[model samples]
Target chain A: MDFWTLANALATGLLTGLVYGLSALGLSVIFGVIRIVNFAHGEIMVMGMFFALIMFRWLGLDPLLSIPLAAAILFVFGYFLQSTVISRVAHLPDHMQFLLLAALAVMIVNACLLIFGPDPQAINISYSFDSFDIGENLIIDKSRAYAAIAAVAISGLLLGFFKYSRTGKAIRACADNYLGAQVVGLKVSHLYALTFGIGAAVLGAAGCVLLLLIEVHPYLAPGYTLLAFVIVIIGGLGSMTGALVGGILIGMSEALAAIIFQPSMKSAFSFGLLILVLLLRPQGLMGKSVK
Target chain B: MMGLNLLADLTLRGRICLLIFLAILISLPFWSSSYIISVTTITLYLAILGQSWNLMLGFAGLLSLGHALFVGVSAYMAAYLFSVLGLPPVIGIFPAVALAVLIGMLIGYLGFRFSIGGVYFALLTIAFAELVRIMVDHMGLIGGTEGLFLQVTEADRQGFDLINLRGHPWMFYYLAMLLAFLTLAGCRTLLKSKLGYYWQAIRDDQDAAQALGINVFRYKMYAVMYSSGIAGVAGVFYAFYQNSLFPESVFGIERSIEISLGPIVGGVGSLFGPVLGAFILTPLGEGLTEFTDYLQSSGLIDPKLKLNGLKLLIWGLVVALIVLFKPAGIWPWLNEKLGFSRKEGE
Candidate 1:
């Protein structure tokens, strides 16, 4: 590929990777705190996207401005789900827990399909079409740039919260050692609900930004769910920074792969990379071995 | 002889029920309409797939979310051999089974060798299935996304043609029934054997199994191979029964999820759980579709209204409730209520 073309692919890939990172970060945080892989993470993201669409269309609110509202709504929803349904199965065997999440995924996706219909919806603001030319050949969509900036900013805020906030430390304590956290009189279940709520809030923000970039549909969740899992695994399961790096890596690889091969084969590349990383480094690039 | 011995072990009531169930299955073609026959055929095949999945998930304590990979691979293999090579499906099935087993072994080796168990193993399987689906969609050799349609000759379509597996609905129905019975018998025998003990051991506690001198990896490989092999056979049946193979319909995550539901909703690890689950789920699913069609046709529902999403929503709710309430599944609970002797493996 030519220099400008390569640079353009890298830029697009990096930008898209920011969104992927943001999405994967939700899954990472959920796994980190709750110790349960939310199979419905992408569905939750799609739910956020739909929520944004609703607010944008019905209330005449700008999609970007609806981010906090959507995040708050999703946070409450996550807290409810964690406290009610997930906590019941938290003590079950691994397979049962997995099946519960899978069932939840089915319920959420199908529920969305029932309510929203199967049609793909997109919000077309003025910025959705606008792009800027950075140099002779490289061009970036304005909405995507804004989404990327939002993703980075959100990641920063999440990192800061986890590092400096009291609730964040409590969540970290619970994640680090569930039993020890309990011994220290930290209400483990409450902490879990809070962590899940934060994770969902992150996804809600990502969904608002994603609305500006792509179409939303019920079936959109599964692909994103799989991608998020791959990114989470690649970045290390519980590491926030790892999720960002892994997302960027996957995004760049997929973009470059599309240029090199058929566009359809890009998913294959991502899955292949996932399998390779899983086989070679189960602990992930940024994760430390627990054992 | 073994079957007879198994029959002898059951109570007289149990034996009678077994005989009656078999008789009903055998006579189904005589009294049932073609629609019922087709549904039953699908249920039987689903039972087979569920049983196969149960071997890994229920017996070996390994959950695979991408079993459609085996099904899709074998179905495509059988379809390809029959269409491109002009071979009979009966002959095509061998290579299909072999290919499925090969793939199963590859996955098992990669997974078990690296000690990848639990949810990670499930994710690996999902990734493999997706990768295969994408590759198959792009490969022109398999007709790409347009899919490959198997040709049925006039003679084959009209009567029982064992070679091409093209015949009336009853022929496929009987074939499916036989396959289901054989799979049940095979699973029952395996569950009674020493291998079953080793599998249960590994499933319950892999470290303890290793400490007790069981080769956890080899037995786990055995479970996967057997599971994939059975799934491959079901795929061959599916190929001929459907008379077409598409990458999306066969290899999609939905297909995997559908196959797993039978075992999950029915009861995992029980011999009859998959069969019972298939009977319950297939009829409910098909009945919902039929009901929706009836509503649309009878003008009760608007012509423009789409009911599939709603049907799926209800189905999801049912599955969720089942998972929440009866995590061990309905079979074990039913077994207790019916006063049947709950065998250890069963």
Candidate 2:
């Protein structure tokens, strides 16, 4: 392809990748702290998107403005979820745990189906079509830039919280050694709830941002879950930085694949990339070795 | 000697149960409505799929999230052969099964060779399945997005065409029943053999199995090959029975879940688990939809409101509850309740 087209695709890919990375980061945080892969991740994200959509429809709030509201709501849900149902299944085998979360995914998706019909929902701000030229060749959409900026800001905030906050350290301690934390009298279950809540908040904000770029529907939940998984595995499961980097790589490849091949083959391209990463380096670029 | 081989796992009581069950199935068409016959046929189809899947996932601990790939590939292969070259499905099924086995080997090689197990291995299978589905969506010769079709005349629907594989529901029903019996017998025989023992070894603990001199990689591949081959068989039958094939309908992850629900809910790694699970789930699931339809038609519920979601909500809840409470499934518990010994090698 021409240099201009290539650069444009690259820019767009990076922007979309930010949002994708943000979504995967939510999953990564969950896996990192709990060592439990949330199979219902995509459904939860759809929940966040719906949260945003509902607010936008009823309250005339911009999707961008509704990000924190969605995140807060999701955080509470995640907290209760971890404190209750997840605690019960935490002791099960990996496959059983996966199935349990997947079941939860099914329930959540169906709940959406019952609440809102199967039609895709979207937010149509006045600038949905607005774009700006950054350089001689590269043009970016207004929504894409805003979403990317918001993603970076939230990611930074999350990282800072993980690094600097006492609650973050306690959660990390539990992840480092749950037994050790319990030995030291840390409220491990409550801490786990906090971590899950934060992870969910990340996804919730991401859902709000995503609604700007695409439509939301219950059926779309699984595909997003798959996408987050693809991103997380590529970056290395349970690695936050890995999620970001993996997201960009997949985003770029998919964008370029759309230009190189048929648009429908974009997912195939990412999956091919995932297979390569899985076979060549199952641990991922930034993650530790798989035990 | 022939009789002994047939009685490999079954006790005398079990044999009596089998005969009685067979008699009931044989007499079903005489008394039951066409709807029940068709539903039973569907249950049988699910039993076959679930039994095949259990061989790999339950027996070898190979979690395949994309099993529909095998079914889809086999169905499309058989459908294409029949539609293009006018070959009968009975014959076309061989090549299709062979292809499915090859595909199975490809996935197994990728998974087992790399030592990818558990959910990671499952993810690998998903990638391959999704990849194939996308590629197939673009291909035009075999009817890409629009899907492939088989010809059916008004006469073909009412009367049986045993030769060309076009037939009435009775033909398909009998074929499904035969396949179900074959799968049950095949699994039973395999479980009694050395290969089945080795497979269960790998499934329960790979490292320990390897340390004990069992070739974990080889046996796991065997599980995948047999499972995928059987899935292909079901696929070929499904293609011809439906007289049309759609990519998403056969290859989608949802289809894979549908295939797996029987084995999982009925009980995994047990021979009769898939059968029992299929019998319970298929009828119940069909009934669920029918009940929703009833509500919509009777104006008890909003006609415009879609109830499939509510149905699925209950379905997922049931699956979750089963996984939580009856992890071993209902079959083994019932088997024990009736005083039959457990079926697994260990």
Candidate 3:
């Protein structure tokens, strides 16, 4: 295709990948901390988007402004969800968790359906369609640009927190050694809730960022779930760098594949890439190889 | 201790119960309402598919969310054979199952050899299923996205050949029953064999099993192939019964989820759980569909209520509830409550 067209696709792909990375980061954090797959993660993220969308309409708050509120709400939900429901089932046999989470996903989606219905809803910002032309070769949508900025900012913030903060260190400590962490006086139960809260909050931010590009629909959750999953695995599970790199790789590959092959096969292509990456490096790109 | 005797006598009592159950099933078509019969037919199909999935997820402990791949592949194989080569379905089904088994073995080889299990393994399987689905959707040879419908003609009427395949729901129903029965019996037989012990040992402790000199990979592959073969047979029955094949319907994620639901909800790694789960959940699913349809028809609920997502919601909720409340599943919980413990070759 033309340079402008290719650039446009690449930029969009990058944005999409970054968003995927952010969400995958959330998923990885939860998986690393809790050891449950959190199959409802995608649905929860979608719920965040819908929640943000509703807030934007009701109070006329901007999507960006609504992110923290959405995050706070979901944080509480996640905290309770883990402490009450997920944690109890987490230590059970594998299939129990799978079924439990899958079921919870269904409930959330249905609840969304019951409340929101199935029609696609978009937050109507006058500037939603606004964009910028860079040089003679590229045009970037304003909303996507904002989303990309937010993604970078969020990723940086999360990275900084994880590396420097005491709670973040405790979280890492727990992931590395649960008994050791507890022995060192890190309250394990509260830490688990906090980890889940952080994960949910991150996903909430990602959801708001995602809503900038695509309209909200309940069915969209599963698709996002699979996408985040692919990115996380490709990037290396529970690795922040992996999530970032995996997201971008997926976004670019999906965009390029859509251009080269059929658009419907976007997911298929991502999955194929995931399998290839997994076969080559099961531990993921930035993580130590697990044998 | 008393309950233990009841459980001890269950293997004998269970057979008689199954025989009576079979007799009732055979007579169901005769006495049951047409609506119930149709529902039963679909349920039987689900039961067969669910049982097939149990062979992998339940026995081998490989959690698959792409089982619809086997089901869809088998359906497409049957359809392609019948429409293109004019092969009799009876013969077509055998090869379809064979092909599906081979495909399963390939996937199992890749998965086990490369050491992908848990969510990663589940994702790989999902990817394979999605790839096949996308290919089928675009491939115009089998009617593409619009789907393929088989023409029904008489076995012998003037110049037309009639296969007697159409409008014969009972035949397919009986076939499904036979397959389900065989799967149940086959699973029981397999579980009591050396291979079954190997699978359990591997599931319980992979490193330990390997340490004990078990070829963990080979046994896992065999489990995958067997489960896939059984799923293919279900697919064959599914194609013949529906007389139509669409990539979306056959190879959908919903189908994959439904297959796993039975074994998980019933009780993974246990006999009788999947069968009971199918019996319970299949009807519930049909009832939900009907309720949605009723709401749509009566104009009492939003038209969107009849849409695809609600069923997903229900299925997901059921799974979650089962996990939350009955982690070991109804049968396993009951078995435990009655004081049944693992015995050595009892």
Candidate 4:
């Protein structure tokens, strides 16, 4: 309501949105290239968080330092997942593919539950609860700021990779037109594995950053999966910039809705936005219209 | 006459198989344990849900992931009426069905009008279901997060009471069986109708269907309404049988997924697919839970190591294997292997 309070909410929303953007980037990329909605993306992200938690708790490493390791591990896991299991159903009907992903999601979530138990775990770095006052009544949490910074840096690196690397260009080409890319001698299946791996790596890094700010649990994947879906739909499916913008918009609207109503209703706002965007503009803000 | 014709259409082998299956089910209470009867009741309800879902997903090609919305809302509606208004479930179910149909049409309109098909349509359904679930969780009027319980009197629980829908386990079992039978018959009838052809056409190719002058939107809406209505019937049965309603249990995404699995595993478009799926899946699911409980009680497995995830893990593996192997589902494959003529209008 007040100026500084509003500004603080805005800042918090933007920072949180960056994390959401990072989380959604992999989903967008996978969808863009493979034309498959990876329902297990969120579970993969949670796996990353668990990986980070393991590094921090058992090995006495900072979660921030564990990001790359977690990402690398997830990259391999995702690559194999696509190459082995997902590729089997790559040519199946749309609903079958959807069911496969849904099954994978259930498997991963429950598998994590079996391994980790149902407890919520968080990484406790030195600055976990520390915050700094920027100006007037506006303050920023140290972990949130650090997470946001990491998200932005990772996103920038991804953008650079997509722009400059040959593999990235091949991925883009495959996403643009799979048949054309195939005609041009792009190993589409191999590229698909690589793209999925990249997506998983991004989600892994985002998960590490997320663990710095919030608790992680086996059940956490569905909510984030839904959130990423909302963000991607709003931003335009398969567009990097769209995911970032959409994530921020969702985060801001959620924050604003929390200010207006109850915090429990934040998801209502996001879902509402998703339905609206779906009905009014299925193409989304920055994506091409779906045929 | 229609029923006679349908019966007449069956081959001698089909008729004999049907008679034997019916005899088995009718005599179940006499020989099988109460646990098996209850599991059968659950399977029957799941069959209804799966068949209902198949009407839309398999025939109409509208992939809906939020079917729990219909079941949950209808159950809550009927439960609320029974508890607060003191209305019997038989009467309460009518309005619940109406509400479910109305909601189904609204969603169908929104989805089909915008040409939202495939996964996008599924997401739309999920969003609506989640939105409703969250809202219901906060609404204390209908028990909110704590849930509502139906009152079952001693007399009602002891014997058959058709009015209040409170009776022995056999009573619910019979009711569920009748419902499942009627639903199967109804689906067969629908599939034989012109609307069924239109649905299949639209499912096969919406653009091509449109070119053929089929009213795609209207037929699709009909599918949604009919499917939701059937699911609403299942919900009413659920409320009366379970005698309790929880937003999390009823409206959860897991519930939606569970409802869809029967149809997916059985055979999506086939008439007997849902029934076969439910028969296979429900017992397996219940058996896993019972096994885990037994293991825990017997100290065969560590109590500290929670096996809560084991059932779902197995379910996931089963579903994955099915999707990978028999994507057309088990019924059609079984039908082929058995050399039975395919069910009419599939």
lDDT tens digits, residue span A1-291, model 1: 788888989999999999999999999999988889988888899999999999988987777799989999999999998999889888777666777777788878888887788999888786778999986688998998999999999899999999999989999999888889999899998989988999999999999989988999999998999999999989999999999999999999999999999788898999999999889998789987766
Cα lDDT of candidate 4 equals 0.89
Instruction: State the C-alpha lDDT per candidate.
Output: 0.89, 0.88, 0.81, 0.89
- Candidate 4 colliding pairs: none
CA lDDT of B222 in candidate 1?
Answer: 97
- lDDT per residue as tens, model 4, B70-133: 9988999999998899898889999999989999999999998898878889999999999999
> Interface RMSD of the predictions, in order shown?
1.4, 1.3, 2.7, 1.2
Tens-digit lDDT track for model 2 on A1-291?
A: 788988898899999999999999999999999988888999999999998899889998888899888899999999998998788878876666777788889999999999998998788898899999886777999999999999999998998888899988888899889899999999999999998999999989999999889999999998999999899999999888999999999889999999899789899999999999889888888889867
Ranking by lDDT: 4, 1, 2, 3
What shift in Å separates residue A90 of candidate 2 from its native position after superposition?
Answer: 2.5
Clashes by residue pair, model 1: none
lDDT of 2 at A102: 80
All DockQ scores: 0.68, 0.73, 0.55, 0.76
- Winner by DockQ: 4
Alpha-carbon RMSD to native, per candidate: 1.7, 1.9, 3.9, 1.6
Ranking by DockQ: 4, 2, 1, 3
How far in Å is the alpha carbon of B46 misplaced in model 3? 1.9
Q: Give the TM-score of candidate 1 (chain A).
A: 0.98
